[model samples]
Target chain A: MSTDSNPITTEAEEKKEEVYEAEHVHKVYDIIAPHFSATRYKPWPIVERFLREMPAGSVGLDVGCGNGKYLGVNPSLFMIGTDRSRGLASIANHEFKHEAHVADALDLPHPPGRFDFAISIAVIHHFSSPERRVQAVRSILATLRTDKENPGRALIYVWALEQKNSRRGWDENSPQDVFVPWVLQKGNKSKQPKEKSQKQAKNLVETEVKATASPSGDSAQTRAACEPEEEKKEAEPNPVYNRYYHLYKQGELGADAVEAGGKVIEAGYEKDNHWAIIIPA
Target chain B: MKLLTANFITCSVKSCQSVTPALSFRDAELAREEIDFSPLFLRNILPRIDWPLLQRTAKELGFPALPETKPELSPIAEGDEEGVGSEEEQKLLKELHSLLLETSVQSGKLVCANCGHEYPISQGIANFLLPNHLV
Candidate 1:
């Protein structure tokens, strides 16, 4: 991958990555939050079990809790969820009545070493650089409690590169950095793209998809599956917002946790995602 | 955001880490929404609550002043785990539930003591994403 051969080291490169992510990841989620949230009501079984097992009244953080689906899983536990997108955070607060806020993962608003536990599900993969990914993990680990007898833990999950059985067909050999498309079907009054002309939006999506798909052969299939078929009446194409994802290879999630000064208690692949339970070192 | 949630939040800016009572409420609009009362949950969470901070928050939000010291509940006996405690304990737990989980800040600004960065709360959701300079 280009990121491997040309590592992001300079300040300018870091700033560029931030801008890139803002456009590809943050803005895309904001545009698709309602539609995205409609399909995200189900809590993954492992995450539900993890939340249920925590002692009642344990206070925890949910870093990048999109739509706050997991926040209300355990009524006894008090969990404050933060998401980068204001749109998703608002849904979390309004629809779910969960305590959620808009906050970036790297610059969280919580006190360090105070929370009893934290969960970052499918969040860190949005970081465009390896260093930023590790830094994001470090920021999350900082919020956990450090007591020896009952140390706070974090549960993190990221999309796995080795998901051959999945529909996307990404494997270990596929380029880790790629743009995943999110097609916003027309006529969804709430999910319309804001402040962009149709031509401009189409050009932006084409350029991004072309630039990022050179290494991956199945990009077309990915886009085809994302676009819904019910929009045949609309003359213009559905606005496809490409999201950047750094698909993790096997063991990388645990490695990132260790690099961020955490000890991996348990790690495994579950349903095309790599998840780990980690604690402060 | 709940009155209870404010105790856990601090200024997002890195330099404001040492500021005591990390955030203060400004023009907060309060609402009382009834939720299920759970005494066992309150007993379990009491150890983690910052009494002084909670007191300060309660005062700022114009609620009745909290007790100077954190309340202590007797240990749960083997068979009485699910039973609500004696009348006194039940009263305390109900008060706490009304204050912490039921009373929510519907809209306001959370001002940092050190940096003076105001995180606006709208529709009961606080926006803690800082500007580029702070990041």
Candidate 2:
């Protein structure tokens, strides 16, 4: 056997490497895909709104769609459960895997404007930085693009189940983990791209943060923070969304993300203690 | 609605901005996706792709693609073996992103090639459109 004979195969094998060495992440929901039927978990009502509201049969990009619990709840919803671990994907394929795919949620592969809705659950907190969480949410929303025909194509993203003291955060009280559902629609296309300056976008972010911080929608601390007459701008004053949805401590993700996106349309949190901020969709 | 080609339209919770990368797909900058032209590009690009997402995307974008098991890189073709650098095997890498990335097929009834669901791509968007009758 000469060295030249097997070079290609050897080189090809280098692309795919096993990750999360301990398999800690993979073990969590490896078995859930099979036993995840709504008949079992009984969390279907929370996820039902998502199914009911969404345009029937729209492609759902499940970020960390563990074992297709949402799929088990509603199999008709064409789901693509994505996970970083192959073990979980294999188990998903065996049981509730409508179409189990092993991939990173952060770097989703579909062309820009792919899915009608994106649902991510109990995943973002795992990252070690506010920037990572921010980037992750932005990446998922990237799937939602403007609709050409509808003029205001709505993109729903329900980022429920945030960890309060996520081990991923820098400090125990870090305000990085908060549910901020995003909806990007059309209609607002008339305004040129340059119309809304970076200043306005920055201000919107600041206002969102202030609203979250002040329970009554306005407060003295927020007033002091908002006033610009004499105050100097803190280069990064609450860049992350600190207010809005209540953050769940660690692991309280009761609802499926796919269903949550669906909820944005129909009931609008009529039941769940959760209500979305309702960004322009 | 908006024609965004190489330029990307990025949005945060508060705003949306369109960006265009400086890199042009010229000979000077052979894209990692140009693996079909040379295997080295495949070797380099594979590491950068969100493998699992890429795999899911492969399935999502009309190909039942799977993420790599690990970060493994190797030569697609041996210039020494063929007595020439064959740009054949890496074609998948070149076309994979083009098949997956550059092309955005907006507005159609996207039927899952596998599951047989009629997902509508309405308004330059694709959503798995199930019916009330199904629900």
Candidate 3:
């Protein structure tokens, strides 16, 4: 009964924590890919402009090209897309009809100078560490075509820690780590009795949310098992899945891009995001 | 995975570009009809195609021979204009178009010449997940 007899050590506990952190991000993306894609159908104007202005027939790369949204902006430019998510990559190739691969942004499959131009939109910020973020940018830079006459360029987008809207901005004093909210929707089941229609169902959902937040005790599976069979058969309530985000302050991304051996051409904020354009140095 | 375009992929290992004839393609799927072939579009794309490397790749892929050297860009006024070039040049363009756009690696492995990394291509999408040592 001695607590000191526990087999787990600090190193093992820390490793487990690290694994959980990584799982949190990857699992969230896997679960939300479809919902995320549906709302992201429109290509951001700046990204559209960047792709459109790329020289005709230049080879382009779209890193983290979820659903291959901007892959075919310029048909003349042969483009390749990649994403860490296998589901997204499959959607890119089969559904969107774009050439895409399932690859990590930090370690791209293509060799140096493979692309005339490259872009990583809203991707680098997902890295757990600052060093990894820089590595991700540099890795993409290496694949860019670096001829002097037509030096290749890269465009990157990261979430901004500070925004014009106060509600969206984070405190400058704290680390730029935060969790943004993602709401998961489960369709309402029609099998519920007619008397328990809308109002009663909403009340039940609210009560269920409180019950799931149990501070006192049982494991999640235990709690689920304890629920009544009839309740288990009912439509599940919507759950908020908080997503981890590493926000960058103004000039932060540009500085990292430069430190990673890129020459920053432009850096600024748009909406709740900070974006930059750089050329490999 | 059309073997003809394998030249574009290189070793994923650090500090190794690897020599040609290093990476080999297998089970290439040629489906160029899926691409919209516009002469104007292809004309602009012609310059970026590494002719020597592409020829070598095509040979490896078991496709018919490409011209010994890269063809000069057709001097027709507008790529879309009729009588854009002579019959010989037009024939070359059509061949180049098929070689570049139509060929894809649907199911295969892209083995790195130097580090021996095997990047698998399944359902026309390459899974380039490298182990921690390589990363």
Highest-scoring model, DockQ = 1
Candidate 1 accuracy as lDDT: 0.83
Which CAPRI category fits model 1?
medium
Question: Per-residue CA lDDT of candidate 2, range B1-135, in tens?
Answer: 111111221111111112111111111111122212323433443443445544443454354544456344344454444222344434555554354333444444433333333433333332321232332
Candidate 1 regions with alpha-carbon error over 4 angstroms? A1-9, A187-236, B77-83
Model 3 regions more than 4 Å off:
A1-22, A164-171, A187-235, B1-7, B18-22, B27-32, B78-84
What is the C-alpha lDDT profile of model 1 across B13-61, one tens digit per residue? 8778667778999999998898887888888877889899999999998
Better of 1 and 2 by lDDT: 1
Q: Model 2: what TM-score?
A: 0.35
DockQ of 3: 0.59
The second chain of candidate 3 has a TM-score of: 0.79
Candidate 3, residues B86-130, lDDT tens digits: the string is: 767677666766777777767777776667778888888888777
Off by over 4 Å in 2: A1-40, A148-281, B1-135
Question: In order, what lDDT does every prediction score?
Answer: 0.83, 0.37, 0.68
- What's the TM-score of every candidate structure? 0.87, 0.35, 0.79
Interface RMSD of each candidate, angstroms, one decimal = 1.0, 15.3, 2.1
Summarize candidate 3's per-residue lDDT along A103-160 as a digit string, tens digits.
7786676768768888899887777566677888899899887877778899999987
| Candidate of highest TM-score | 1
Per-residue lDDT of model 2, residues A240-275, tens digit only: 212233333332222222322311233232222233
- Model 1 CA lDDT for position A277: 95
TM-score of chain B of each: 0.95, 0.35, 0.79
